[model samples]
Target chain A: MTVSTLPAYPARSARLKRISAEYPHALGLLLLAPMLSWIAVFFIFPTAWMIWQSFSERGLQPYATILTSAIYLKVLLTTLKICVITTVGCLILGYPVAYVLTTARPSTRAVLLILVVLPYWLDFIVRSYSWMILLGRHGLINQLVTGLGISSTSLPLLYNLFSVSIGMIQILLPLTILTLFSTMVRIDRRLVDAATIHGASPWRAFRTVFLPLSLPGVYAACLLLFVSALGFYVTPALLGGPEQTMISQTIMVIASDLLDWPLASAAGVLLLVVTTSLLVLYSRFFRLDRMLGGMAR
Target chain B: MRAPRASLAVNGLAGAVLVFLLFPVLVVVLISFSSVDFLSFPPPSLSLRWYRTIFSNFEWINAFLLTLQVGALTALLSTLLGVPAAFALSRHVKRGQNVVNALVLAALVTPPIIKAISIYLYYVPFGLLNTVPGLAFAHTVSGIPFVVINVVAGLRGYDRDLERAASIHGASPLRAVLGITLPLIAPSIIVGAVFAFMQSAQELLIAMFVLGTLEKPLAVKLWEGVRVAIDPSLAAATTSVTVLAILGLVTVMLAGRRARPTRVAVQG
Candidate 1:
């Protein structure tokens, strides 16, 4: 009787284990349900609704108006211009920093990295406000110039294209540096040493071997910087005059000040389209996971 | 060795860029202590008047508290939603993984202004506008990507054998996960929480639309102040937020250092 009961219990437990093992996929589905549902309701639904709202009232008329209207077209162009400038500025400023970070000793790299990343973690409002303090009429730059007798009066440094560009570039430089550094660090320094041994000058070796290898990183960084700069609102709004109105600020004004929901939605859709297309292109070249992973580190 | 001249140039350029990066931050912190009414490079006398102003003013205090509350809520909600999703994505749900990933990360790719406007419109019809929960929910959509990215990374380095061992030792699946996996990944979750909190706290565009008139977070309050006029009080508010952020960063770094050894030991 004892032997028969033991065999029966073993058989029951084996069946239960099999059932549980088979249901892992179902368990996964259950686990994913909450986040997926939350995203669908809060993220996807609103986005689709906004797109629908854009075309609901006037069909494609709003798009046509945006295309034809001088103000809207100019704002879009200005946004593109600022984004290009900011991207270029970040590249020029960030490359040396990234290169230094990749080649520096571990201890020095840690401190340099912290200095670069500290501003990134700060709020845009803080950074932009800081820029205002430095660029305003009584700002440090103006004060320095006036005190040195270089100029009799303060320069109109705040609320201009120059200020806008400076603020945006400063804000975005860390992102560019980090992205470039991630790619640069992966490159074998031995390759450059090889070129040098083979009678190539250091500058020539960098230009021929290292530069080509690092171009992909440059492309990726520029894409990210341009995409980010395109969506900028706070820096431009604070540091720019009416001339530097970005597509984002325009959307805000249309939505809030003008009370033009369809036009605003249409403008938003256009901005979304441009940014999404660029990112999609970016993902085709580089894995999104790697980019995000690089940023997190 | 490479030429000394090139190395010196690189170091000099890097140093200049670092100074450029940090100068504005330094200026802001310094100006916050000014005794003068107007913006100035050098404070004639150092004073706590602006800090006192921020503390004494009801609106500023209200905004600060609201921002903290929203940030905390966003961190909690995103982590609760994101951790399980990370586990599922990394370990389970094999089919359509790419599609799911893209869907999860779509928020990060989408322009912030688009997100702000869309959420603002959606919330208006649902009567969710100007409510803390509403704004928190909006922020959570953005926050989830940060949480998922961090937690998924943590899970990738994790060994599945630990869970298998737990099960073999008669621990149920849920019990094993709760007892072992969660604790092991707690540092990642905490870091994710920090990112989520910072994202929510620093967010201005969405908060501008979602919490328009009745409620204001610190970002919005600063935006208003900066738009109207530049004041030392604005500098004081920014300084406070920057200091808080620095503390958060320091805490995360320490936590990461402490967790590193334990993680390495477990793997070995």
Candidate 2:
């Protein structure tokens, strides 16, 4: 790595410096200013306003209500429980798929990769609705279950936490696989071979040489999955019963339906705080740039 | 060689998961052909009634046309703004670029609801609430980052010495970039544009915040169809959207594959 601490603008050539120095990094700043301003105005400003609104009187009441009431608290707890289960489910299911993808030939790898990403092409609403049809009382699952003599009539498949988790796991599993697969590809194959030559079992070779190196992707995937799960609106709103309410759906109801911007803003602000904190924690333990950039292990 | 049975079991299990993954789409496709009014699986009889209904309905057509307009506009604007920004970020190792990079990541990471709410609040003062331009603007902001990320990945993998050599032969900086750099990075730029188009097509939360009752995107249309009507015709609309999205993706993949690598090649 080049570690030269040359200032961004170096006076290496006096004549060229004389011509450009007056601009004082002006070109780069000029290019960046518009996007920076756009984010500041549209992104940072709204978030700051949301936080401010959260402290106001109306927000405090809902904030008090959410924190004090058992119903809201129960929902919040259930959301977290589901997020953890989904994360673990993705890890279990995704690891082997990721491994197989990485070990495959390049052409095969490319096709498999595309297959994994293809489902995500559909709109989130469409995907959730597709699940709604599949998992409904008289839907495919119940029909198949009855055909196999597993149940008498259609089962109560919709309007439950099970449907919510199944939908999320489907949407999330591909991402986890891709992330972990990229990291695994960067690992040194010789290390595994070296373990094998030293008489380590196949499982031991992976455990000792592979898994530790792959932790960054696992952590990154979990972080992305958790934050994404927290922001979920459409899936739970469609598949979930009244009890499986997530914070995003709650925010929408409060802001749009209930005509309470402050309360909605408060919930949005809380969601942001919780998700951002999880990201910060992940970044602390893992080099997120490496995972996101899909670079070396 | 531990156990053939274990290997069979593992393959069998994976096959089951794959089936589960595909089961929903399969069900929807089947439901779309159902003859019954209420959604019944293993349709008593099959017909194209719902598909015919889709064309006859003004609401579906209007929402679809509006979505097409928004998607096209968002894709165009995102490419215009994002391509140059990605070029600048990738080519430079300037001071405080990391902070700028972090800002983009923050945009990517922030929840859609948060983004929608922010745009809503910001637009209220400018009377931009419930407007197409406002919704398009929100889509553009989010969409640009995808282009930037993809294009920058392309740039990072590029060899920079080729441009320096062209400049040494006395070519102008703009000519060197246009002739040398653009040719090499075309694939990534095309990929970025494709991603931006897909993002614009699927977005709903922004439309929820910015669109008025008069104009709604296809995703918003889908949402309402699920909540309000829950009709059999909704399946036909859903099927069409899926087909449209896949076709758009295939078109991009083909265009990217066909993009000439040397059309913009350097001349000395």
Candidate 3:
């Protein structure tokens, strides 16, 4: 959708373009320098520095402590748990939306997709903040609770595992739905119809045929969402209780609140390693370019 | 091509989920216009006090202006870098492009919290943390990828023959690109820049880590409000940003007609 509709650059003039004829790579290299150097300086160099600082300060001790200590391990495990839960929650909420999308009128699907995009484009911080407003002590949820006489006082909705999950789920549900919808739309409905013709119930046809066909999309969506959920800071920071401390927040504490750079860097590096491993796994099994390209559409 | 409508029960459940996803946005807008100080569902009465309050207050005004400047600067810088790289990947280079793509998309893969801390480490000793340029620079690392992905997506389908024709007609390669190719991809460029701008506008985690007293993006200010107290003024700021987002999204969807509206679609 982005590139194919436009015309291509099919030919170069026979006359040597003096500037590029001298060195083809020169122009290309020059074009790439700014972005490459920007990444090198701001991203690569700093990440290198952090890893270096993490090791140099205590000579592998920060990594060791994180590995050995139950405290750090608990946070790491909890972070993993949160990411998993968020992914599962997204899948649960998303399947119906995706199914609805495929079944809807085209105009209706367009509107549904746009509404999903609205929140998806919204800032993560703003979304989290809105959740705070909607779920806080004096928030809408609490007001409704009291107004409905369900509870005399505000339910503890704002700061807990529940709020954190709510915020993360809200942020991720659209993503899962879109991915599933895109994949679901491409499924050959005739296969399901064939199953129904072969004495399968509608539910049986869907479960056996459509569900199996859509597993790839589900896998891709879960992988993407889980990786993102692992690093979620805004939702957890704003909506979570003390028990909900994810690895990202723990790193922030080490870096900022506790002012322990080495531990922070070590933690940061651990996160990078895990995420990069997932990405590498993605590239290994699936063509990442296509995954990303399809994702773009 | 269509089957009978799915069960009514399925539609009912789906509608409920859609409402859940959209509720926060709707709630925020509603609260932003509330007359009462207390945060309540549906509001006690309608008023523009929160909206007016944001304009009159110095901090809110300052944060809003700062956010706008940072977002614009990030957009400009990212476009300057990302468009060419997109062209290079699309037209010129091929062998090491995967490595390039990986590096470009690294920011998306890595969590924002980690990016913030790492950038904070980079900026701290140089005294660049919290400064406008530094913040904008931090944003560009993430923003440039969007520019690359977007512009490259636009580039994939671009007709090279147009440039070829221009070059054959006595225009230099540079002029061919400048006049013909660039204009053709102008919508993609604009869409990329809009994405970049929106990235900086809504970014707060990095802002929180690095921003000094001098510049507070609206997101950061709102975060402070969330941390310190629940205030209607925060809702006002949120509503304004939401309006900007709507405009930006409309531009993006129009520009790259079929591209995913948000990077989070992939990121999530």
Candidate with best lDDT = 1
> For residues B103-167, what per-residue lDDT tens digits would candidate 2 score against the true structure?
66567667788888867876788898877767777787777777677667777787877766666
State, as a TM-score between 0 and 1, how close model 2 is to the true structure. Answer: 0.87
**lDDT for each candidate structure:** 0.83, 0.72, 0.78
Calculate DockQ per candidate and list them: 0.48, 0.35, 0.38
Per-prediction TM-score, please? 0.89, 0.87, 0.85
Number of the top DockQ candidate? 1
Best candidate according to TM-score: 1
True contacts kept of each: 0.52, 0.26, 0.47
> What ranking emerges by TM-score with the best candidate at the front?
1, 2, 3
Chain B TM-score for each model? Answer: 0.85, 0.81, 0.84
Q: For model 3, state the Cα shift of residue A169 in Å.
A: 0.8
Model with the higher lDDT, candidate 1 or 3: 1
lDDT by residue (tens digit), candidate 1, B48-144: 9999999999999999999999998998899999889888877777776666676765676577889999998888779998889898898998888
Ranking by DockQ: 1, 3, 2
Give the fraction of native contacts in model 2: 0.26
